[model samples]
Target: MKALVYEGARSVSVKNVPDARIERPTDVLVSVTTTNICGSDLHMYEGRAGMESGRILGHENMGEVVAIGEGVDKVRVGDMVCLPFNISCGFCRNCEAGKTAYCLTTNSDPLTAGAAYGFAGMGSHSGGQAELLNVPYGDHNCLVLPEEAQERQSDYVMLSDIFPTGWHATELAGLQPGESIVIYGAGPVGLMAALSAQLKSAAQVMVVDRHPDRLALAEEIGAIPIDDTLGSPIDQVNQLTNGAGADRGCECVGYQAHDPQGDEHPNLTLNNLVHSVRFTGGIGVVGIFLPQDPHSPDRLYREGEGEVAFDFGLHWFKGQTMGTGQCNVKAYNRLLCGLIEQGRAAPSWIVSHELPLEQAPQGYRHFDDREPGWTKVLLHPEESG
Candidate 1:
């Protein structure tokens, strides 16, 4: 099988690798159809996340189940399924509590409490960015799709990650149906957050970014595009809300938070969210924040404890409640899937490129650079036309 492997900083290659096979009684073998390049993947691609060479680099995946282990009773061969990025046991204490993102049984290291495919520090599971992928706990991990799965691969594939992640941000922020919300970052996840806000019938949805292209996408969805380059985002939200600020806020920029000049500020988005959300409002942050980043400009982030200096005083004075973490995808995927099946949602609108597996390198380059019109890229492992 050919798989995407990390070569080094800002480099990757497609090379022949060992075939994927069922390795456990509860495992399933999948012929991967669609895979995604995620913003979080950039952390590894840029060499800031300590990704080892020879690691397959995808986590958002969906495909046809080619084979199922004897112990897998619910999933069957030929079923189209989307695998959650988190590799949870479904029987762990955390899983039982609806916290599958922090499942206790998946990651090998005892210190790590969560796991995901092809992610650094998440565990040993290989990702689904190849012709074949081995999925463990198949009965629990696979979310079987409807009959329209094949024709709607682009839309359904998002069930594997970003769609649910975006919805998770809304849930974390405690967004109410009639409330207004502002989301920082117009990247894929943030865009999905905007979509989720709309689907939930928010009175107003505002997206912040310096990228004209991304902000334009936000406009296409009827969201107010707040170009941070034009003025202070806090001021923009305040004006939009008639001086009260938005009802809630979401932080999707994570630790790579930066300004239009490309200067990295690990806490820029967080501080902005704190000030932009109305007093006593809630904030949900689904962006990836590391305890430390070797590539970060802040000395605290470079030291393995990714703590950034921010205004805890204002956060407390404002009495804002906050939620932050990797999204618990399973918690919202089913509900969102129903919306897709009913033709009420179309997350695929964010997909900007569809390339054959062989062209992954080019896709990564353009996406990494945030090239115009390359907002999101999906790779077809079988190289279908």
Candidate 2:
């Protein structure tokens, strides 16, 4: 099988790898159809995240089940499914509590926070970027798609990660119908967060980013666009909200946030969110933050320790509440899928490019550079029966 194997910093390629097959009684082997190149993948691609070489590098995946273990019963051969990036043992205490992302039975690393597919510090499960994937806890993890899944792969595939992730951000922020919200970052997840805010009937939805294309997409989705390149987002939010600030705010840029001048400052976005929201408002942070970054030689967070210089003072003084972590994708995907099936939410609008698996490196380059108009990139592994 050919898989996108991570080479080194900013390097990856389609390499022939051993075939993926059922490895456990609870496993199901899937023939991958559509996978995405996510910003999270870029963290590994640029070596910002410590991923081993030869590791298959995609997590946002959708495919058809080809073989299932005797223990797997929810799905069978020929069933199209979307695999959530988080891999959990359903019987764990955390899983029992709806906290699948922090499943206690997986990746028992006390220092790190969650378990996920194709990520360092997560379990050894290979990702679904290749022609085949072995899905563990198949009945619990694989989301069986509807009959129209093939025609709607682009939209359904999002249920695996970003779509649910964005919605989780809003839920974390305690978004209420008719409330005003501002989301920082116009990347795919941020854009989806804005979309979710709209779905919740937000009276005003504002999205902040420097990219003109993404800002335009936000506007197209009924969100007010705040160009960080043009002016101060904090001030703009104040003016837009009649000086009261947004009722809630979301931080979607994570630790990769920067100042208007493009200087990397891990806490910039969080601080911006704090200032953009009203007193007593809530803030949700869905951007990826790491305890250790292998690519940063400057020791931004101390070796093996992920710490950001957050404005705890302002957050406390303003009496704001906050929620942060990887999304518990299983918590929202089923219903989101139903919404998509009903023609209500079209998450696929964020997709800016589609390419074959062989063109993954090019897609990586464009997305990593965040080239103009490049918001999201989806990859298709050659179909296999």
Candidate 3:
């Protein structure tokens, strides 16, 4: 099988790898049709995340089930399915409670509670950025797609990650219908957050980012684009909201957030959200924050126990609430898929490139470099054959 393998920092290669097959009775073998190169994948690609070489690198995946294990009763061969980024046993305490992201039974390490394909510190599961993917807990992990799935792979594939994650950001922020919200970062997740806000009927949706191309995408979705490069994002949001600040805010940039001049400030977005959101409002953080960054030049980030100084005082003084964690994708993908089937949501609008699996190396380069027009990338593994 052909797969995109992580070679080293900012390096990847398309190589023929061992074939993926059913490893357990509850597993399913998928002929991967579509997969995505996520922004989070850049953590490993950039060497910030310790990813061992030779690990396949993809988590956003969807495909046709080529085979199903005997224990898999619900899923069948030939079914088109989107696998959530999180791999969990549905019977786990967390999975039973709809918090599948933190399933206790998936990761073998006691320190970590979640498992994800091709992610560092998650689990041993191989990624789906290949011709074949062996999915554990098949019936529980595979999200069967609608009849239109074959035609709308671009949109349905998003069910694997970003769309639900974007929705999760809003849910965490406690966004109410007609309430105004501001999302930091206009990357793929941020754009999806904007889309989610629109679907939830936000009275005002504002997105903060320095990238003109990304901010333009936000504008396309009727979100007020606040360019941070021009001035203070807090001031922009405050002015836009008549100095009351937004009713809700989302941090989608995570810890790698930097200024327009490319200076890394781990807590920049968090503090920005604290100031941009209205007093007593809620904030949701969906961005990835590492427990440690050994390569960080900042002493606090290297030794503060995953802490970067943010405005916690203002957060407490303002009585603001925050929800932080990876998204429980299974909780939202179904309804979001229904919206897609009904022609209500089109996440494919953010897809900027579709390439053969072998081209993933180039895709990673462009996306990591934040090249213009490379908003999102979908890779077709089958096309590589």
Candidate 4:
């Protein structure tokens, strides 16, 4: 099997790896058709996530089930399915409570509660950035796609991560129909947040970012683009919201946020959201914040153990509420998939490149560098079957 293997910081290469096969009775084997290089993958690609060398690197995956274990009763061979990045057991207490992202039975580390494919500190499960992938708890993890899935892989593949994650931000922020919302960052997840706001009937949707291409995508979806490079994003949001601030704000930039001069400021977006959102309003944080970043040049991040200089005082004084965590993708993928099948959602609009599996390293390089027009990249592994 061919896979995009993580070699080191800012490095990846297509290498021949051992074939992926059913390892348990509840597992299924998928012939990966489409997989994405997600923003999360950059954490590992840049050596900030402590990802091991030779590990396959992909989580946003969808494909044809080539084989199914005897214990797998629901998912069958030949079924087209999208696997959520979270590898859950479905019977854990957290899973029962609709918190599949924190499933207690997946990760071997007693200190950790969740597990994900091809992610550092998540689990040993290999990712689907290859010709074959082994899916455990097949019936539980595999989201069977609609009849048109073969023709719409680009959109359906998003159900694996960003789309649901973006939707999760809104849910956490308690967005109500007709309420205005502002989302920070115009990356894939942030753009999806803007799109999700529109689909949920937000009266006003504002997206903040310095990238013209990304902000343009948000504006194309009817979101007001706030270019932080030209002026204060908070002031821009205030102007759009008649000085009351937005009803809600979402932090989608995570710890990698920086100023226009390209200096890392982990607290930039969080503090901005505290002020950009109205008094007594809500804030949702869907950006990936690690427990620690030893590679970070910021002394606070490197020494204070990932603690950002957040505006908690302002947050409390404003009487704002907040929610933060990974998205429970299973809770939303089904409904979002229905919307896709009905022609109501098209997440593929953000896809900027599609390449063969061998070219995954190039895709990763361009996307990680934030190259213009390289918003998203999808990879197709050549079928061996």
The per-residue C-alpha lDDT of model 4 at residue 132 equals 94
lDDT of 2 by residue, 139-212 (tens): 99999999999999999999999999999999999999999999999999999999899988999999999889
lDDT (Cα, 0-100) at 178 in candidate 3: 90
Q: Rank the candidates by lDDT, best first.
A: 3, 4, 1, 2
Question: Model 1: residues >4 Å from true position, as ranges?
Answer: none
Q: What's the residue-level lDDT of 176 in candidate 2?
A: 99
Residue 330 deviation, candidate 1, in Å? 0.9
lDDT score for residue 56 of model 4? 92
Model 3: residues with Cα > 4 Å off, grouped in runs: none
Q: Give residue 15's error in model 2 in angstroms.
A: 0.5
Residue pairs with backbone atoms closer than 3 Å in model 1 (clashes): 291-305, 291-306, 292-306
Of 2 and 3, the candidate ranking higher by TM-score: 3
Q: List runs of model 4 lying over 4 Å from the truth.
A: 383-385
Worst 10 residues of 1 by lDDT: 291-300
The runs of at least 3 residues in candidate 2 whose Cα sits more than 4 Å from the true structure, single-residue gaps closed, are: 108-113, 294-300, 383-385
lDDT of each: 0.92, 0.89, 0.94, 0.93
In candidate 4 the C-alpha lDDT for residue 186 amounts to 95
Instruction: Go through the candidates in order and give the clash count of each.
Output: 3, 1, 0, 0
Task: List pairs with backbone clashes in candidate 3.
Answer: none
Error of 1 at 216 (Å): 1.2
Q: Residue 189: error of model 1 in Å?
A: 0.5
